[model samples]
Target: MITEPLEGFLPLFRSWFDTAAMAEKVGVSGSPENLLVELDLGPMVEAELRLLNHTPANAAEAACMLEVVRQNMGDAGRSDGLDLRAVAAVQRWLADQSTNEAEGQPVERLLRRARV
Candidate 1:
């Protein structure tokens, strides 16, 4: 049997994050791991979300993904390999975007921090 692609859930998670305004509206906080636990996504989906979000070339995409991850993890500690400086950067950007929805903030801001 073929296993499902964890990345496939990225869009779905992103939609929820945007619709629910998870970070700001839900009062979720801390690293993505914490949010993932809160959202009850379990360890696997949480890991997949974090990897995809942190790997994205665009900051907004990364942020959007981060929001979902954070919402799911809640205020719990992160799993090994899930916590990194680059990952933290993406999470911070997502937090910033969640707080400021104004269009004035250039989208390029998101791409600047991308590892690629």
Candidate 2:
């Protein structure tokens, strides 16, 4: 979905689907009773979400995203550094994805890729 000035994110989708026997139908498509695959989601997002017990990331300033970016951009000096910029970017993204918005907002999605 990224188009302008794109950046790459590491993929960390779920490993197996048959490992867990789900009682509810979490599949958005395909056969509900028989899962064809597990949910796939960004690794960083998955970590943060799991800690929150699936709670949506709140606040316009996401510490987790900024930290991840900082770690990824480590050792880069001011001319090549991005600490401040990354934090700002995460803030903007979180704001745009706020669930408290009026309606039809792009809230943060909790999607985890699964394989069955």
Candidate 3:
């Protein structure tokens, strides 16, 4: 099924990380497995969001998606696999999301790290 909705894979990611951390805290034997599907699906979801011109539903979602874009963008001068149009759309949407000073910092920090 399509999990591209704002409430989909992102939340799953958060949950998985949280669960993993808790498991580790309890001295679990191993970390969460990096399933091949999960690894492969990230790029597909990223591409879908970019091509569809997806806008985040809220500040939290924006922040999350911005990270996705940032990772896809990589460090300075590394395009990775993201296209110019997609990057521009992501930038415009992210710019429109910074409604307050507190929220703006994360966006700025992520952008700086991503160099996008």
Candidate 4:
């Protein structure tokens, strides 16, 4: 199965980190894993949506996906495998996400830290 869309991808990554101790030794943070994926997904999802001609017909599903992405993005905890450059990209994306004071101070702090 392709899995249940947005949720399972994070776990697969976590499992990889669990086994790949070398990524840990090399200074990587798994904290931003989901956020990294979330950022990358924007274009991919858009393209897929375009191809399928699917306009997110279900409001609840759309809301769920958006919420999950935001939660992941905001979680700036240091895990493993996330480097400075990777975090920098996440920082840029988070900055873009903070439109019209939508994210508040805590999220801002997370964004700053994400810059590593």
User: Best candidate, lDDT-wise?
Assistant: 1
Candidate 2: C-alpha lDDT:
0.35
Who is ahead in lDDT, 1 or 4?
A: 1
Residue 17 displacement in candidate 3 (angstroms): 7.6
Best by TM-score: 3
Q: Against the correct fold, how does model 1 do in TM-score?
A: 0.32
Candidates in order have lDDT scores of 0.48, 0.35, 0.47, 0.37
Error of 2 at 81 (Å): 4.3
| Residue 68 in candidate 2, Cα distance off native in Å | 4.1
- Please give each candidate's TM-score: 0.32, 0.27, 0.34, 0.26
Candidate 4 residue lDDT tens string, 15-90: 4334333433443445665334333334443432222221122343334334334433455622432232233433
- After superposition, which runs of candidate 2 have C-alpha atoms over 4 Å from their true positions? 1-8, 11-65, 72-78, 99-116
> Considering lDDT, where higher is better, how would the candidates rank from best to worst?
1, 3, 4, 2
Per-residue lDDT tens digits for candidate 2, residues 1-116, read: 11132222212112111211131235335565545345553443344333222111344224444544454455362343344455545544554564334333222221211111
Model 1 CA deviation exceeding 4 Å by range: 1-12, 15-54, 83-116
Candidate 3 lDDT (Cα, 0 to 1): 0.47
Kindly provide the TM-score of model 2 when superposed on the true structure, using C-alpha atoms.
0.27
Candidate 1 deviation (Cα RMSD) = 12.2
Q: Tell me which of candidates 2 and 3 scores higher on TM-score.
A: 3
